[model samples]
Each structure stands twice: as structure tokens, then as C-alpha cells.
Target: MSGEFDFTGQTAIVTGASKGLGRAYALWLATRGCAVVVSNRPAGDGSSSAQAVVEEIVAKGGRAVAHDGPVQTAEAAAAMVEIAATHFGAPDIFISNAGIQAFRPFSTVTLEEMRELLDINLWGCIVGLKAVWPAMVDKGYGRIVLTGSSAGLWGQKQSADYAASKGAMVGLARSVAIDVPKGTDIRVNVIAPAAYTPLSMGSIDPKWADYASPDHVAPVVGWLSSPLCQSSGGIYHAGAGNVRRAQILEGPVHRLAEGDIDTVMHALDRQPEWTSSFASGAEIMPEMVKASGS
Candidate 1:
């Protein structure tokens, strides 16, 4: 992979940056010449875990500030953006990386748990975007990266709430990309990351831990949150020093003459192949036409 992007004079806000993946992202951005806001919820002693991350970056002669709060709140989100603007400048990047997961089966999961998951995982991204979007629009440039999970892409047995939240993030990123005004440089994308951080490892499982370090995932995130990112509304899978694009592909269209069981059965019997996977809906139809021999 080519590391060929400049982040000079840029500012980045990374949520849940106390440790693990978020901390890695913040530090990597700092090394690339971007001032960073390290944000996370305060710890039990009323001190912020993000404070340590800020200290580490500053020790390395990098610019960083810590903002501690429940980022799901609009007030907290606005405060983070204001800190970024007041301390550094208008933030050029926003990494909506804060989230929580409940590991319970669908039938056993409580409504309260579901609500909390949706609030932290899905609503947090919306709140962050609301805070930074106007500044980005006015500046005519921004890179927004929403963190996703494999659970959302392929559901896991005991993560129904987590899966639902992540699935929402994917849709949110796509719609946000479409909503940006024309001729603007704002870009939004989602990453379904697979890293063995504190969140991934409840206990130290040595088998995957070495291979799935958070550092391995930071490179793809840096590229996605940089000016050189070529694609928006795209979902990338990153971890273990490997990266790949994930997309929703469609099979050949079976345009039926009538909505009948017999016609549907015939179409199913044909079992048309998917000629290609698309990054956006706009690319789907033309490829389907070619695949269908229409």
C-alpha cells in the first residue's frame, strides 16, 4: 500500500480514543502532521482515559487535546468540535469510532441493552456529523470515517444489537455521502474492521491477538481519512495488515412480464450469475443489463 497523503495543518477528532484502536488512529494521524482531539468517556476517578492518549502524542511533539464525555449527547459532540476548532482549527477529519456492543442472543437481549447499543454505536456517528458537517461544508473539504463491524456484515450468534447498530452505520455513511452538496470535497465511508483490541478481546486470546493488533488497522483508516481517498460511500475491511473492499453485489435482473408464482419460479430456475459487484447503486443497472443479455 502507498502512503502518499499530506495532512499538514489538518485537525482530526477521534472518539473512544482512550486506548486500543481509537488510540492507534489518533497517534497515527498525529504522526502524519494532523493535530488531533482525543475523546472518550471519563473514567471512574473523574479523570479521562483520553488524557493519557493526549499526553503520549504531546510527548512525541505532536499536537493533541483530550475531551472526555458521553459522545452520544449532542452537547458533548458540539463541545468536541468546538475544542477542535478553538485549539487547532476547523477539523478536516472526523472518525466516528465510539461504540458499544452487547453479547446476548436476540431472544434474551433486553430492550434497554438494544437502546444503549443503538445510542452509542449509531446515534454517536450522527451526533459527530451534525457537529462537524457545517464547518466541513463551508470549508469545502472533509473526510468522515464511520467505524463498522463484521457482525453487521455477517451476523454473529450473540450480537444482535451490535449487528443492527453497525448495519445502520453503513447506511448512514452512504446517505451522508449522497447528501453532501455538489462540487464539495466532503467524503464519508465506513470500515468493518477486524482488530483484537480491548473491545475485541474480553480476555487475552493469544491465538488472534498477535495477528490482529490495532496498529495493523490504522493504516487503512489513515488512508480512508485522508485527502487521497479515491472512493466515498465505500466499505472497507481492514485488519491483520490486510485490507479489502466489501460490497453488495446483485445477480442478473429477471424482469418478469407479470407478478406470478410461475414467472418467479422460472426466474429462480435460471439462477443468473452476478457479473460484478458495485460500489454504488448507480453502477448496478448497466452491469445487470449486460449480464442479462438484454
Candidate 2:
């Protein structure tokens, strides 16, 4: 099945393509016949880690270029996209995979660190999305895959800033899925990836050593960024050679008469099952209103 998916004329911009999963994605895209633009912060005399990936791709008879610059800024992101367009034509796929992590307790997290994480993780994706949106809209086709984290979806200790940034990405993807120009063919989605990369090796416990590698994450990412992906406005969890969709479910809620503080309190104290009823968002609101009698 994988062999059938070819990207002969497509171009992709993969951020954070210096190493890890981003590098893996760039190489994979190239092998699949897509001309790739690799972007990362300037390093090694203003050359980026993406440069190495570009070299590897070229060695394998694939087309690739590296863009070493800050991707957090709208201007820089625009320039990256422009580079792809001017060189290979308008990008058909975008993977906003650049991210950073600062582990600290919520109270101990500094404003500086918080801002840095948000800038790199959240704002970076926003900039990349905006940069490619118009061209994709005009062409009536596009694919975007935003990198999210499991920490963003579930609570984690000492990951306040990281979780917050990732959580914002989920919402960003969801909103964009709904906001794309009506009838436009653009598809936007998020991936909560659990893979062994430089970022995870030291952080994740060794006992779970069988999880997927960064290379494993690329196939799903590549698929999501392909014109072949028909689904949009969705979240997928991919790792350990497994891929599945994830949905935000709501629990059953209870309603109480207005001004009935006692009933509300009683319900709160006795409604264990209601608290456990994990349903959808649409189910929660009406239940809450009924419980509040408002």
C-alpha cells in the first residue's frame, strides 16, 4: 500500500528538519518523490541540520533543499514557504514539526521558558499554517499535519509549559479544520506522537523501550501530509507501529434547579457515575444546562 502513494510533483516544507522525527519526515517525503524544503534554526555557520538531510536525500536521487532560519516568526515562515514555491512550486504539504520542551513544575516554570515553549511549539505552527494557507486555498488543495504530544492531551507532572503549548496546538488544528474556506480541499489535522527521539530518550522511562522510533512516526506523518488523506479536522495518535484516531469525550453531567445550591452540592457529592460518563462535547453542554436549570 505504501508503495502506491507517490508524490512525484508535490513539494513539502518540514520544519525542525535538523534531526529526529523532522529529519525522518523530510527524508521519507523525498523518497516518496516529493521535493522537500527543510527548515531549522541557523546552525554550523548558518547551515542547518536540515542541510544534512538534504544531502542524504540528494544522494538517494531525491530532491531537497534546506532553509535555516527561525520559523517562529511569520515573516520567516513566509520566506520558507516562498523558497519552496519559487524553487519547487507551491507547497502541496506542510508538516509543522518544530518544537521544544522545558520540564518544570507549574509554580517553578519561568515566564521566559513558558514564552519560549509557546513561541516554538504553538506560534511556530500558527505561522507555518498561515504561510501556506492562501496558496493552498487558491489552488483548492492542501494537506497539513501539526505535531502535538500525548502530554498535551493528558496530564503530566513537570510538563506545564510543554503541555500547554501542545494543548494549544490541538485547539489550533481543530479550529483551522472548521475555518478553511468553504469547499476548499485543504485538510488540517494533529498528531499526538509517542516516539523515541532525542527529545524523548532521556525523558521517557526505559521500561517502555518497545515504543516506536522517530522513523516510525514519519510514515503516519507522511500519510497525513499526502493529498491522499481524505479526512480532516481530526486528531490521530501514532506510535509503536500503531495508529488510531483520538476524540475528546465528555462525561455525563447532572442538572439541578436554579438557586438549589443544596441539590447541586448533593449531586456533586453523589454523582460518581455522571463524572465517569465520558461522552462527546455535544452531550455535555445540554446536560450541564439541565443540571443548572439555566
Candidate 3:
């Protein structure tokens, strides 16, 4: 089937484009007529994951350039954006997907490991976003897709560091969506992809493997990166050839004008209207204010 979305004359940057979901997203964007910037760390041979995607795009009559560098650094990310502009003009779409995952118990996670996880998974995206924000705002058009994971939404045992970093992505996207300069046509969205990328599914059941291919989640990323997507500051779940809206819902809260320790304990013990999640700050803040009479 033909894709409903087209990105003709647009430029896109896909980090971690050497393999898996990032690769899928880069190739899919190229097929849809986007001039892509495929970025990754500089491999020993001077080739990177970015180069692989660029080659595929070129072979398929699409325009693309490889940006081999460390996206985790501000200088490297800025350089990558500059290269993209030189090759195909300003990037209209940016996908921050560079990350690494390690399995270890919470007690075993070292401070260094935690810092590295947050640096690459969270700060890397922040660097890229800041690098591109200016031109995107100047042009008054931009689409940003941040990589989140199911682990970010639902806690995973033995994945404390990775989960924490991914959770931070949701907060970053939400802040950007609400705080971008007025009149800028920029939209930021998060995708909690449950794909069997290199970073995930090493120990998952083989029979269920088909449900988590990177290709299955590409369409959702494509749609979110398209000009037709009117929604912004939203989170979505994509996998198993299915794309659906994922939301945070607040449970009914109890109001207490003044509560002693016992009263607080009683309210907690009642366990009324329990829900799995809560809505965004936008939705819950008003209720919070009303509840507090603030």
C-alpha cells in the first residue's frame, strides 16, 4: 500500500541510524521523499550507522547524507545539524533515538553507569533539540519525535537506569511542546515503541518476536513526523503493526482541608478510585489548584 504521508523537500535527522528502529525510520523517511541526515558514532572504519542508511537511500533514488559523530556531545550534535543543512537545507524533522541499554539490578547500578545512561539517552536528545530549535523556530515549522520505551511508561525490573532516562524524555518533550516560542510551528511528540530492536528483546520469547519488529513501528513514527499530524505534546505506543494513542489518566483524588497523620493514613488505606496512571500536568494542574483552593 502507498503511504498516506509525503515529506517532499523536507529534511530529517535520525540518530542511532546504524541499525534497528533508527535505521527503519531513516529508510522509511527517505522512501517518503525526505532528504535525511543519518547520524551515529564514528565507527573504526570511519563508517557509521548513518552511512549505512544513506547508502540504502541513495540506492533507492532518495537523497541522504551520513553524519558520523557523537550525538551525546553538544559540539557533535551541532556539527551534525550543520552538515545536514549543508547537504539538504535545514532539518524540518528531528528524531532522537540514540541510546544504550544494560540489564542490572538496582543495587548493582553504579553512579557512573547511571550518569552515562542519562547522558546518552537524555542529554543527547537535549543537545540535538537545542541545535535544531533555532532554525526550526526561524522557519516556523518543525516536527520532533523523541524515542521513549515501554519501560519508561511501565517500570521494568533490573532496568532502573534505562527506564529513568527514558522517563526523562517524556518530561523533556512535554516541556518543549509547551514552552516553545509563540507562533513557532513546532510540534514535539514521544513514541514509546515496543520494538525488538538491538536494545530490547534479547531474552523475549521467540514466538512473540514478530510482534516487535522495527518495521512495524515505523509507520507510527512516519505519521508523527508528517505535516498532517495536528496533535502535539502527546505520547503514543506503537508495535505489532498497531499504533494507538497512549494517555495518562489521573485517579479520583481525596480532598482533605486539614488532616492529621491518622486522617492521612485513613485516606491512604481507603484506596479509592485506583488507576494505573495520571494525565499530563496540563490536565491535572487545574484540578490540583481547585482541590487546594490555590
Best lDDT among the predictions, by candidate number = 1
Pitting candidate 1 against candidate 2, the one with the higher TM-score is 1
- Model 3 Cα displacement at 213 (Å)? 1.2
lDDT of each: 0.82, 0.79, 0.81
Clashes counted in candidate 1 amount to 0
Q: Candidate 3: misplaced stretches above 4 Å?
A: 1-3, 44-46, 206-209, 265-294
lDDT of 1 by residue, 9-99 (tens): 9999999899888999999999878999999999989988899999999998889999999989999999999999999998899998998
Candidates 2 and 3 compared by TM-score, better number: 3
| lDDT tens per residue, model 3, 172-192 | 999999987888778899998
Clash pairs, model 2 backbone: 250-279, 251-277, 255-290, 255-291, 256-291
Ranked candidates (lDDT, high to low): 1, 3, 2
What stretches of model 1 exceed 4 Å from their correct place?
1-3, 256-294
Write model 2 residue lDDT over 117-168, tens digit each, in one string: 8899888989889999888998889999998876777656788888788878
- Residue pairs clashing, model 3: 18-49, 248-278, 248-279, 249-278
What are the per-model numbers of colliding residue pairs?
A: 0, 5, 4
